[model samples]
Target chain A: MEEEVVSEENVTPVDEAEGADQEVEVTEEDARLAEIAELNNRLLRVQADYDNFRRRSREEKEAAAKYRSQNVIEALLPVIDNFERALLVKPEAEEAKSLLQGMEMVYRQFQDTLKSEGVEVIETVGQPFDPHLHQAVMQVEEEGFESNQIVEELQKGYKLKDRVLRPSMVKVNA
Target chain B: MEEEVVSEENVTPVDEAEGADQEVEVTEEDARLAEIAELNNRLLRVQADYDNFRRRSREEKEAAAKYRSQNVIEALLPVIDNFERALLVKPEAEEAKSLLQGMEMVYRQFQDTLKSEGVEVIETVGQPFDPHLHQAVMQVEEEGFESNQIVEELQKGYKLKDRVLRPSMVKVNA
Candidate 1:
């Protein structure tokens, strides 16, 4: 467009070649119309490109934020298990009584916070085994349920949004 | 183009009558070439549109995955803080000792996992204050450092890739 653009020098050079010529001046209307059309086309393309770029950037940011926790959350799962185990213990001694109470509060808060944050626990026990969410480690023939039903979850599944962050290790009834 | 596209049959009867008198025999070659050209043009546009659509879908998926953790990680920050505090505790008693050790191991692994996943701790101390990474709450005139330099970080900043998740709160040297 820069090379093709009409300049004052280009017009003068061409006009001078036809010496002593009667030149009809281009009208303001024609120039205005040409300019308007060019502007209109450019504006539309610009708007479209901006829209696409906005959409792309937004998606990239979201994807980055989502999976960033994949590694850390999985690493913390063991800690969560330990917390659960400690909380499960009955406070028999005088020293453990206060310690147990504090731990319980921390564990409860952690669970509540994870729940609110879209860290959903995939329910596997007593439900049909799904390959998407469950990994069959051991199969058992159980009564009152379908053959592929989930008998018990050995390790719980976790999800970040619709994507499975971690699949549950389960005992299937198959 | 068929009847639905060209509507050639709807042409005036007079035009057809005029054409019937013409001795010029239009060969099938010209018609086939024209059709091929038209199809090629359509194919090009379709391919371009398909590329655009594919790019859009890919970007959307990436963005969805990225942002899925935004709320989740923010919610888990409190739990992380609790772990950090628990690590700082010196174990003087035997009660809950094993649990503490296990939690410590889990916490270390969690930190390592976050590092691997592009979740970075924004460097805050002993550097020139950058408005992008550091938020200055109070200014202090330090002997060794120049003006607008960070003296201390109040809270660590966090980032994922090039994007800043949280700005570090800092005390700046006057």
Candidate 2:
């Protein structure tokens, strides 16, 4: 009987110690699992963010290439306008005729270069005035034109591809 | 005595079951810990990659803006050369003089626009020949010029900012 009691005491203490150790281990394991879940969520979010950034950067680069010539073309518009005005002068003198011929050749070459770069003059007279492509400088009543039709183009407007570099200055028929 | 033996049998089975459960729990906990570590490493790497990408993208955007006018300017170089040639012709008649004046004004305006965009002509005559900025087409023994010096510029070279658009065609003294 005494041996049995001694054996019982030994087993009971060991069982209690094991129970406490298990409680601590289970809490620690639960914390580690929670950490793993949190880390996984963060990783997914970062990956998605990176993917979005890459796509946006690619789109921006394409747009930059498409519109690369915008500023230079815009700056040259006034120069082209002056060239057109100079070409309109009538040359009566023989010397003036030769100089005018040279000017006309250069002007044609310039136009060809602009055309190759996707530049086009916007049509204005008799067409419907579009606020996106035309700027009305005057409103006039003309017998041969319909309402809201452009009666005359005062200044030429240019577009590069679909982007309007300058709006056409036009007289609108009321 | 029989009851004590029965109680001991019950306790022994419970302890064995608890021991098996603890073993499984420990293994599961270890797996969770390893997963957390791996996920953290991935997150760190992804974040670093994103930082590097953002920096590279910013630099690319700046470079694109700086060189945006490069292609248009290159295309216009031949046209400018023709304009310069036309301006060199002297007008004898009154009408030719006025036409030349208009052409000169337009040419000046064009030059101003180019200058504003950081375009500059490379110096050639009397300057030491530089392979980076000058292309020697003819070597000549010219008087009053040092050896390896540029005697004349056959065709003008241009640069936009620090980048060479074209090297000057030059005659260098042997």
Candidate 3:
């Protein structure tokens, strides 16, 4: 009876060891599954972030191309104004008249180039003056003009493809 | 004796079953490790791609900004040429002289604007004729000029920064 009891005891411990081994394996597999789940989530997030970045970069590139000439055109506005003033003066001598004609052709060519680039003069004279398009230098009560009408354009304003470069300097009828 | 045989058989089968379970556990663990390594490699590749894309986008943005005014400047070159021609004429009458003076001031202002925008005239007369900067309209064996030297500039050329808008039309000595 004593030997039998010892044998039974040994068999019980072996069964217990097998159970412990199974439990350890199960725990390890669970941990690995959890790690895989976390990595998948991170990968998805990163992929989404890359997509958003690509979209934003494309939009920025388009905007840069659209407004590429804005800075140079803005700088040339004063030069255009001076050209207009100079072209208004009439020369009497034959030599100066020929020179003036050549200058007029250049001025017209400059205007054409500006137009092709989507630049346009902002209309002011006889039109209603809006603060967005015109700077009111003087306000007056004038006859033969409606109130808020632009009486004169002191200086020209310009627009480039729906963007205003400068406001027109104007006199408005109050 | 039969009972002893039965008990021995049962013990051996249990041990074998435990060994198989342990083998299965090791295989599962190895598979998880391999999966983790693969995921890590994929993540690293994606990250490297994103970094390259960002660098390329930044470079493209910089180039776009640098060459923004190139098109407009090219368009205005002929207009500038005409202005230069008009300015060379001499007026005799007082009225013509005053008109010419106004035109001269405008021309100066225009040139100043061009300079500020990094536009420059390419040297031709007395300089070595380069195909990149000068177009040889005529080749002559002219005296008092070195071989391959530009003797006369038929038309002015312009550069915006380091980029040539137009090559100078020139006469080169053979």
What's the i-RMS of each model?
Answer: 14.5, 11.0, 11.5
Reference A-B contact fraction recovered by candidate 2: 0.72
State which docking tier applies to candidate 2: acceptable
- Residue-by-residue lDDT tens digits, candidate 1, B25-102: 122323433444555555556556656866886776677565544555666656666767655655545665655565
lDDT of the candidates, in the order given: 0.64, 0.86, 0.82
Q: List the candidate 2 regions with Cα displacement exceeding 4 Å.
A: A1-13, B1-22
- Worst 10-residue lDDT window for candidate 1 chain A reads A1-10
* lDDT by residue for model 3 (B1-174), tens: 111111232244566765764565466567778887777777778778888899999999998888889998898888888888877877777777887788889888888898888899999999999999999999999999999999999999998889898999999999
Cα error, residue A14 of model 3, in Å, equals 7.3
Q: How accurate is candidate 2 locally (lDDT)?
A: 0.86
| For model 1 chain B, the run of ten residues with the poorest summed lDDT | B1-10
- Top candidate on TM-score is 2
Alpha-carbon deviation at B106 in model 1, angstroms: 3.1
- What would the TM-scores of all predictions be? 0.54, 0.89, 0.85
User: Which should have the higher TM-score, number 1 or number 3?
Assistant: 3
Order the candidate numbers by lDDT, best to worst: 2, 3, 1
DockQ of 1: 0.10
- Kindly report the docking quality category of candidate 1: incorrect
Q: On residues A38-153, what C-alpha lDDT tens digit does candidate 2 reach at each position?
A: 89889999999999999999999998888888998899999999999989998899999999999899988888888888899999998999999999999999999999999999
